[model samples]
Target chain A: MSELWFYILAGMTVAAATGVVMLPNPVHSALSLVATLFLVAIHYASLDAHLVAALQIIVYAGAIMVLFLFVIMLLNLQTDPDESPMNATAAIAAGAALAIAAVLGRVFYAFGTSGAGAELPEGFGTTKALARVLFREHTVAFELTSLLLLVAVVGAVVLAQRDKHDARVEPVEPVEPVETEGQG
Target chain B: MMEPLATPAHYLVLSAIIFCIGALGMVVRRNLIVMFMSVELMLNAANLAFIALANRLGNMDGQTIVFFVMTVAAAEAAIGLAVILALFRNKPTVQADEIGLLKW
Candidate 1:
């Protein structure tokens, strides 16, 4: 029964992922990618990474995908007629990617399921276990990640903001506020 | 030969397949946003592999690595989208080939 679920989910995931790559419109691609992310979350659950699965749904499918759709709508993009999505160069890239996939598949198939599905430790895949490992063993890296997020926020704001003093437009001078009450 | 059941190797192979698809998307698509989505796909593939390995090894570290990868991915999305928006503002084209600001 579970194997059936895995096969079904895998098929759906590949189809949706293909949609993300093949769809012409960005909106369609974004939606397809959302579906792919959700299916991947199911795969995570099957792997017994329940906490990660929840985070995958919340973070990837929820926040990130919403942001993507929001940007797609904001941009009001239309499919470009001038540029074809696939070209001779793309064909070459596809060939390279296929070669890589073939090599990886062969290597992994040979690697086999020797040590997989081993006896998991207590509280494995739980939030507690994840947190203990994150905070106790890798606390420094955790703090650094927070710092990275902070920098990203600041950098995004800086990059996205319009230039106040553009070469084309003169900078607007700050006007002093009149004290209406005092004048009265 | 007996039909093989789903194993850790199966999951790993799936990850590799997805990663390849993402790479193909990255190069085949001309749209910057679509390319960015491809990058996300690649990240998710890596995350899936991490979970599979963590489960296989019975180690929490792999899961921990995935958590950090998610955080970094979030940051990358924020920064990358901002850069894209900025570039669009300068030259209203999302097609990667059309943007030739650096072309001499």
Candidate 2:
């Protein structure tokens, strides 16, 4: 775990995260999110969570991001090109959110050292180690997660199913009288 | 001030900053889709904070929780976007401010 790498990766993650928020285009925002997720996955790896790093890429960067992009395309969400996004109300809300974050950061800053200060146990974040805890200790929760995913799939399909928007339609084009060439 | 070495504090501050950015996005953006993306970013920031603490604690549980969070986020995104699509299909717009048919 190199400290230098931690700085680089964490910096990249924050920058990409900012881009996700600040970018005007939803597609760019999603791409920025992809970068942030990748950097964060690398951050997890540096933190010794190799399995998490891999899953982060697969589940988030791979699947979820594609979903976002698909939705953006499906809806054809408008891309805002205006340089300024902050209306008066939005500015106030941004200020309030920043203040809250400042307070939280200050609270954490008061404790300079990591509170836990526990040295890593061997095999702490390996796939095998995590699988044991997940499948054995948290079996019920794991199964529930699968159930949740199933429900989400069914719900998505039910919600997103396309049907006729309206029944009223009048033919605008002049219908040419059908020439009965072969009909008896 | 630039620390020569990376500290948990640095990571925490970064996490906090990103979380706030996500919050700002949520509040400032009119588009429901962008709002949803902001929520995802906030979730990511939370994940970062968790992993940082887990690293400090040397706990496997945090990583495990991250797994669950990822799963839940996936499910949430699926359902939420589907809901958004449904709304758009009915109303033909994604702007949060415009879809106020029931509001009195």
Candidate 3:
């Protein structure tokens, strides 16, 4: 039953992710990304990481994607025309690289069978277990991640405000010239 | 019953296919936003693989890593969209080829 759920969620995730990339409209892509994130949350649930699953939905599907939608609306962007032709050389190169990487990944997985005998620690899926390690062993890295998020938020606000300044400044010059002409 | 639905190998293969599709999308799409979505797809594919491996190994570390990845991905989306907005302000378009100002 769990395995069945895994496959079902995986299918949903892949489909939504494909939509995210294939949809021409940014709004649609953002919506599909939300769906994808939801499916990923389901996948996490199947893995018994309920807290992570909840966080995935809350942080990604809820908060972050809402920000994406806000930006899309703020920009009032139009769909891009299909003007650029595909670069055949780059396509071929990328394909070759993917194939090489896939082969290498398979080889590496096959040879590095070191963790086969390892066992999951007790209470592995419990919030207590996660918090213990997070606060004790990985505390510094965890704090650093929060700092990174803070920087990202500040950076986004600054970038968005910069454009507002440009919008305010650009129209004023044209209006001033018209007023001077009218006075003359 | 029903052969346990499917095995880890099945999930692994599916993850690979999904990853490949993401790679194809990244290569083929000309829109910057679409490219960003494709990159997210690739990251999700990696996450799937990690989960499957974690399941097979019976560990929670993979789940922890996934948590960390989700945080980073959110941050990435914020920063990336800002950059996109900045680029659109300058170029007025998000098409990849139209963005050639820095090209020499």
Candidate 4:
């Protein structure tokens, strides 16, 4: 039963990831990315990393993707007809690399043993273990992350304001009407 | 106690495939938002590898690092989208080829 569920979640993750790349429209891509993140959270859950799974949902699917949606809506950006297609040379190269890598991966895995041991420590996925490490062992890094978020928020506000200023300035330039031959 | 059909290598290989797909998307797509989403996909793929290795090694540190990575990724998305929004306001387009003011 667990194996069946794992396969299902894995399929969802792969499908969403593909959608994110294949969708032509940016909004659709962002939406599919949200689905992918959610599926990743489920994968984490299936792996018994419950805390990471919960944070994955709350932080990524909840907050970050919402910011993406908000920006997309704010811009009201429509698909431009002038957009170029994906580069053929890059696509071929990437495809070949992926094929080779996949083959190598299969070869490596064929030699790996399924009997490799994995004994998770008690409270491995508990919030207590996470907080203990985060606050005690990684306190400096935790503080730094918060500082980084603060800088990002301020930078976003500054950037948005500058754009608004630019918008106002663009309209201030006087438009000169062109004289037609009939008028002359 | 239970039988394991797939090993850690299986998960690692799967993660690598996903990561390659994300890399391809990042390289081939011209739209800035799509590129950003592809980057996020790559990060998630890395997270998968981290968790798999952590589980195999019987440690929780990788999961803890995944937490930090997710936080940084969120912050990155915020800043990237904000910059994209600003750029769009000036150019009214998000195509990577056209955004070349800084080119020397």
Maximum-TM-score candidate = 1
lDDT of each: 0.85, 0.81, 0.72, 0.77
Off by over 4 Å in 3: A1-5, A81-119, A163-184, B1-7
Candidate 1 per-residue lDDT, tens place, A133-174, comes to 898999999999989999999999999888646732542332
Model 1 Cα shift for residue A163 (angstroms): 1.0
The DockQ-derived docking category for candidate 1 is medium
lDDT of 2 by residue, B36-70 (tens): 98999889888877877777777778888999999
Least lDDT summed over 10 consecutive residues: which range in candidate 1 chain A? A168-177
TM value for model 2: 0.86
- Where does the lowest 10-residue lDDT sum fall in candidate 1 chain B? B1-10
| Per-model DockQ against the true two-chain complex | 0.53, 0.48, 0.38, 0.45
lDDT of candidate 4 over A1-184, digit per residue (tens): 6566566767777788888887787799899999988887766765667889898899888998888888778878677565444567666857775786588567645633356657777777678877887888888998999999899888878776765555676565543233344465
Question: How many clashes show up per model?
Answer: 0, 0, 0, 0
Candidate 1 lDDT tens digits, B1-104: 11223566778888888999999999888899999999999999989888878777779898899999999999999999999889989999888988987998
CAPRI category for model 3: acceptable
Question: Which candidate gets the maximum lDDT versus the true structure?
Answer: 1
